[model samples]
Target: MKTLGVIAGREMRLALRNRSILITAAIFAIWFPVMSAFGVVAGAGGDAATIAGGIAAITIPVGIFMGYIFCADAFLREKRDGTIETLLCTPVSLRRLWEGKAIGVAVPAYVMTLISATVTIAAISTIAGITVVTEPLLLLHLATIVPVWIVASAGLIGAAQLALGMRENQILGFLLIFGFIFIIIGLQEVAPGGPGISPVTEGILAVAGIALVAFARFTAGRVTRERIVLTIP
Candidate 1:
């Protein structure tokens, strides 16, 4: 537990020190929600359900995107510069290291998600001249489901970055970003009513997020130092 904290703290410090990454992430985190809220307010007229649905739609993708950005620094950069090899020589298990890294990344990413949600609510309220309150299901999605998804996303991406060559990781990164965009577009097309933030949808997404986290853990466990070393370039 102490080792995990130490590792997590290290990653957090690294993330904080990287001003460029922090600035980029903050911009996206703030930009997407504010813009979405504007569109929703203009079209939907400050309907609470519509606001909640809009928040739900944007927050998850933004959270995952933040995780994706940090994964490059947390996992890929270490492997690229050979620092991961030194960490591999330590007493900590690879799984713990990966978990710590994921936690570190997820914490900030989730915070950014919260910021995005808040900005969305504020923007909607400001534009429509009404106070905004999130629905219970939407609250549940933000409090639990979104963070879990961030961790799962970071863990999965970190595992892949550690196990793959630089070229492959670059390709994976591109695909991940585009994949999320396509998913959002598909959901909009399939459910024109907006992101349906019902109990059933939240429940299914929660289960899927948990399953993805477990899968990421399994994949991280399978990563060996030799495999990472061989893949480094």
Candidate 2:
């Protein structure tokens, strides 16, 4: 438990220091929300559910999506620089390391996601000339569902980075981006000529998120230092 916390803390500090991570965080935290609000502006104005859905559609994905955007190199970079070997020699178990790194990547991104969601809601409501009130389902999604998604996403992707080769990891990163993009587009389009994710949709999101968490745990059990080291370039 202490080892996991230490690794998570170390990764958080490293993420804060990384120029690319900061830049990416800034872009999504500042620009993506405004852009999404604009994209869905027509239906979002003065509708709580629409507003909440639009906000979730954009902001919820920020944490999980950006988790990989930043952690695509979680193990790949370590391997490239010969640090994976050092980590392998450490007393930390592979599963613990995987969980720690996932939490490390997910935590900061989750904070940024919260900030982005708040900013988007405020900006969108102000633009629409109305009070912003999130629907219960949407609010739940932002507060609970999104964070779960982030954990699941980061855990799975981080584990894969350790288990897969560099080329495979790169390919996985691309696939994740594309898949999220598709989900975003689909959610926006399916919101009934508006911006809200319905209760039913949010339910689906919750189920899917839980499933992903289970999948990540399954993947974590399969990660081994030998395979990670053998595949290192």
Candidate 3:
């Protein structure tokens, strides 16, 4: 447990050193809420649910992009730079390393997600002067979104790096992710609406996220450059 915490702490510090991560955090913490409020005001006449839905719509994409930034290199960078070998040679088991890294990536995303959600919700309440109830369902949705985003972001990013890093075709991986996001947006339009729907959607997100985590784990444990190239071709 101590070893895992140390690993997680190290990754967290490295993420802090990255300017892009800081910039993204600032955007989510401050800019996103202000922009969401403006968008809601500009769109006008919608009920709070509709406005909230709109906010979620915008948030989902930004969330995915943020996920990419936060997670796309959870393991690939280490392997690329030969740090993985050093870590693997340490006393830490693969499971601990994976768990530690997962926590390292997810923790920041969770914090930033909460910050962004709070900012957006507060801004919306202030501007619309709407008596917003932070009801159980609303709270549930907020709670679920953070973990969902973390898993989805970590899984997708980790999988992409493992799958595409060999070809040095990272742009293709990003494009594919955006394509998936567009599909998700389109699907949301077709789905039946309400708070009840959030749980179901989150369940689906969790499934995909777990798959990615599994893939990351498997890749880290077993896959090699030769295997990656063979699989890609």
Candidate 4:
């Protein structure tokens, strides 16, 4: 656990030192949530909670996708800088190191997502002269689903980055970005039809979230030190 903390701290420091990454993260983290909030409040002619829940269902994925962008360089940057080899030699096991790296990015992204959502809610309330969102489910999402989803995504992306060569990494990065774009588009198509928050849907998402984390853990285990070391140019 302590080893994981050290590894996580190192990743956070790296993220802080990269001005471009920080700026990009700031833009995406702030922009998407605010837009989603205002759009839902203005357009959705329904209960505030229901509208917020619908907005959240679609927008939360945007938050996770933004988190992925911030973490896209999680392993690629290390490999490019020639530090991954040295980091691999540290006392931490491969699984712990990878999980920590993902967690490090996930923690900050999740916090920013929460802050962005809260600020939007407050803004809507102030402007509309009514509480725009009082959804317990939206609260539940920010509390549980968002964090787990971010961590799982970062962990999987990190593991894949460590395992792939530079050319492959670049190709996949583009694919992942476009993939998220399509997902956002798809969400927009369905949201207008008014997706209900059935208990079954929530259950499926919870199960999927847990499965994603487990898949990440399994992938981390497969990211051998030698494979990563050899992949370094």
lDDT of each: 0.82, 0.76, 0.62, 0.70
For candidate 2, the TM-score is 0.88
Error in Å for residue 29 of model 1: 1.3
Q: Backbone clashes per model, in order?
A: 0, 0, 0, 0
TM-score of each: 0.91, 0.88, 0.73, 0.83
* lDDT for each residue of candidate 4 in 87-122, tens digit (9 for 90 to 100): 877777788878788978887777767777776677
TM-score, cand. 4: 0.83
Return the candidate ranking by lDDT, descending. 1, 2, 4, 3
Candidate 4 lDDT trough over 10 residues, lowest sum: 187-196
Cα-lDDT of candidate 4: 0.70
Q: Highest TM-score: which candidate?
A: 1
lDDT of 2 at 143: 81
Predicted structure 3, TM vs. truth? 0.73
Please write out the lDDT profile of model 2 over residues 139-205, one tens digit for every residue: 7877887888888878877787877787888888767666755765565566454446777677667
Q: Which runs of model 2 end up more than 4 angstroms from their true locations? A: 180-195
Deviation of model 4 at 199, angstroms: 3.6
After best superposition, candidate 4 residue 176: deviation in angstroms? 3.8
Ten-residue stretch with the least lDDT total in model 2: 187-196
* 1 or 3, greater by TM-score: 1
Which tens-of-lDDT digit does each residue in 162-211 have in candidate 3?
A: 44555664675577567657755655655556322354555554555466
What is model 1's C-alpha RMSD?
A: 2.3
